[model samples]
Target: MSIFLIFALSKINYARTLIYIFHLATIPAIFAGAALTATSIGITGKVLAEIGKLSAKEGQIIIGAAVLDDILGIIVLAVVASLVKTGEVQISKVIYLVISSSAFVVGAILIGRFLSPFYVQLVNSMKTRGQLLLVSLIFAFILAYIAQVIQLEAILGSFAAGLVLAETEKRSELAEQVFPIADLFVPIFFVCVGAKTDLSVLNPAIPSNREGLVLAAFLIVVAILGKVVTGLAVFSKEKLNRLAIGVGMIPRGEVGLVFAGVGAASGALSPATDAAIIMMVISTTFIAPPLLRLVFKEPTGSPQSVSSEQ
Candidate 1:
């Protein structure tokens, strides 16, 4: 849907306007499309919890769908990154990337599942401080390095490592330790993203900047509509809050920033395009919490039920 919207706009006078006004190129436009497809599990999950719906059926479905969305988004990121690297799309290369990325994630999880018992035993035998954390980081980095060697994103490997570790007995303990590390690194990551983004393009005072603002608006609309429609795709006999499910998938949050950062660092995105993406990210992230609260509203005396079938 996003790709079609981008490409369709590119063929019209709007495309020419984008090129002349916003300096958006075909590749960056497509990159923007891919970026639009992301749903931030972090923000969405937090919002669901805040609204007292985190354990509800709608929340569970949204969480599961968001996880799948991130994985698929990562795969799309790999393919898009390759396009940025080579400067042209090769059907064969795309095919290889799609296959290799899917296989790598699946294989890593399967192999890691088998190895997790030994990993647990190894940690159990260790008397050193932070042994579990240290070993887990090592495992994650090893997979990350392997992913880099395979020409895929290191984050993909890290994600797969996380999936593997999540299945272990020490999952809760590991998460407790990992949170501090995530706290330390996640800010730095966002800092880098903010530093790389040229915010001047978003200013309305400058005539040239207006184009980017307009582009950002277009992207925001596409981003919201694209995910909102996913609710309709739910095929179920239960009377579920499909609107809540769709709204839950709205926030782009950190994941969207990663895409923007990658595009900026790769030099695929023009300054205007980069700014537009950043704006889209911020807008979606902020809007989702309130929108979610509104959509999940229940009657004062009624039970907080997510589905009639529940």
Candidate 2:
């Protein structure tokens, strides 16, 4: 909602005796929305861990909501990418895309639910070392591939795979083995993303890049507000530090960067626009942690966290 409102307001042409801008800037609007839709799970999780609140009520809420946010972000990315690829923004087409993407995710999780027990049993019966971890990874990759084939983002499939694995009794062991691999590869992936960014686009000396900077400013405002609003919407019997959760969700970290990188690679976003997205990511990353620390400095000591009973 924030992204759409900001993009629409930014391109307003009130001088023409109208309250809105023309549809000529549709692609840019999509890119702007896509850039703001991302949230950095890595950063949010780390902040929760660093503050020793991962098991706390507010922390758990942020973690669960952040997972959903990431899934939604990827779905948004797929929709925007499809729009750019088709070069048309028909409302019907968009509706179909959204429904399909959502159904695909839901279906994967449902299927995984029924099959997970059998899958775990099969893996346990295997006569191989690291069978559980190996099967878990293969399942993730397979789901990812299926998602791509079905026009949804691969992240959706991986997330579904995670859902499946979480239902298994060996989740702890799987995490033990998988954490090392993730720790090793995740930094390498981010390094590659950083290396691909063209810094020249951000240089102020370039007169053409100035417009993107203005757009970036607008995006930053909306991005911050969008997440903050999420924090405030925590409805529970136990009082939660809503502001803290909101700030916790602020950093776009790697997710924002990945979306911008994909946009640039697909030619859906111009160099200047990509630079703007990168700047927004950097600003949010630098701002969110300190703000969260400040908000959560003294625990409110709420009676209950967000539990299943709630």
Candidate 3:
């Protein structure tokens, strides 16, 4: 889907207008398309909980798929960030990135798994306040620093740390401790992105800005259709709420914003292109939750019958 979006959006003249005007290159278009591939597990999970489907099979599937999507998206972001830094695409570098990224994630999980029992034991033995939280943060930061040293995204390492620690007995407690940290830092991150973004490109009153508006509209359509079609991939003898699954995957949320932020910061994206990507993210994030609720609200069969059929 990411590849298709990159190719398809790049080929469209409207989508490339801002890119041609500012960057005189296709990388911004690529960023725009790549940004579309992100699905926010945070938003999706919340919606699933709201609709009383978080524990349901479809909900579980979407959540798991979103996690995979995020991991892959982070890898893609790393590759794109590298491309921006080097200003060229080298197949050898790309291959190396792919291999190293996979290895970093897999290696981290394996090593962390082996060490997790000790990790749990150490935390349990600590009588100091906030010991578990501090240890977890230290572990995550170490992995994140290692990722940076290895030229991969730090978020990937943090995410890998999360996966490993989630298997431990303190998963719930760790999550509780992390919530306040996320609440504090996440908003600051968004605020920084907003401060850096040139919102003037989105103004329709300006003639040139109209192109960006058009580009944003195009992206919004592609973003919606791109994710909605993913629902059809579920192949099973028993019926499932495939539409719900797809809709659940549609919100780009903070993940999409991260792509846009990286693109803008790297100077790979023009103001118009960056604005368009941001608009696409905002549109998808807002649109998906209600659509998901509506889709799941539809009559597909009783839960009992569906379970029996499964």
Candidate 4:
């Protein structure tokens, strides 16, 4: 929804500029779309844990879909970033990226499933006791490198590596070993995202920044709508609470900020546009969690009333 809305809004606001120089308009629009691509599983996961619903069916669906959503987001980013550099949205390129990224993810899981036994055997044969952990990290990095080599996002490779690792019997042990490393690094990443954001651009006192503030406000509405609409995608396999699931998917959090930061660094997002994107991220992050908790509390409430509470 953000992608479609931002692209439509961009055309309205920047169509003349786009006509004169397509790259100028499209890159920023791409940034807007990219910013909305991924959800922060951390936020959703914490909410689920807090509600004691982590083991519930809705939780399982949300968590599972979120991983796939992240993968798809990376693929979208790769395709859009490629378009920015090339200054054209080539269908062939998009198709290739879609196929390659999907194949990479699916292939990794299928191949990993078969090779997991051999991997276990190999790990046992190694003389080093801690080699399993080292191997897993190396594997993720190697996949990241390979992804870069293939003109895809490195996250694609790393995520695939993770999927592969997940199939192994040692996944729980590996996760335990890696949890500390994640705790160490994740904060630094968010810090960098904050550092890159020019808060001045969000200041309403500045006449020039007001436009971005307006855009941010508009983006916020669609961002919420985009995630909320995902509830409709739920299969009717059981009497599931779709509102709670959709609300669970609402927070963009760190992942959106990360995308915005990267776009700024790459020059795809102008300062004003970057500020708008950041605000969009912040709005969703702040709004989604509390609203999610509320909707979950009253799952049978009308959508109108549920949304009004937010």
Q: Candidate 1 vs. truth: CA RMSD? A: 4.8
Highest-scoring model, TM-score: 1
Question: Which should have the higher TM-score, number 1 or number 4?
Answer: 1
Candidate 2 residue 200 C-alpha distance from true site, Å? 1.6
Query: What is the descending TM-score order?
Result: 1, 3, 4, 2
Whole-model lDDT for model 2 versus the true structure?
0.73
lDDT for each residue of candidate 3 in 1-310, tens digit (9 for 90 to 100): 5423432343344335535654446567657767877889988898777667888988987887787777777777776776677888688987898788878888988998899899999999999999999999999999888988888777778878888888888999999999999999999999998888888999999998987888889788878876777665666566778888888988999999999998998888889988888889988999998898778767554565334432
Compose the digit string of candidate 1's lDDT tens values, residues 68-154.
777777877776786788888688987898799889998998999899899999999999999999999999999889988898888
Model 4, 1-310: lDDT tens digits are 4323433343234323432433347567766766665678989888777766667788887787677667666666666665566666678987887788778778888988998898888877889878888888888999889888888777778878998998899899899999999999989988888787888887999898877777777678767876677665565669988888778887888878867866787677888788888888888888877887777778655564444332
Native-to-model Cα distance after best TM-score fit, residue 73 in candidate 2, in Å = 1.3
User: Model 3, 25: alpha-carbon shift in Å?
Assistant: 3.0
Model 1, stretches more than 4 Å misplaced? Answer: 1-24, 298-310
Candidate 4: how large is its RMSD? 5.6
Local distance difference test values of all predictions, in order:
0.80, 0.73, 0.80, 0.74
- Comparing candidate 3 with candidate 4, which one achieves the higher TM-score? 3
Task: Give the TM-score of each candidate.
Answer: 0.88, 0.82, 0.86, 0.84
What TM-score, to 2 decimals, does candidate 2 have?
Answer: 0.82
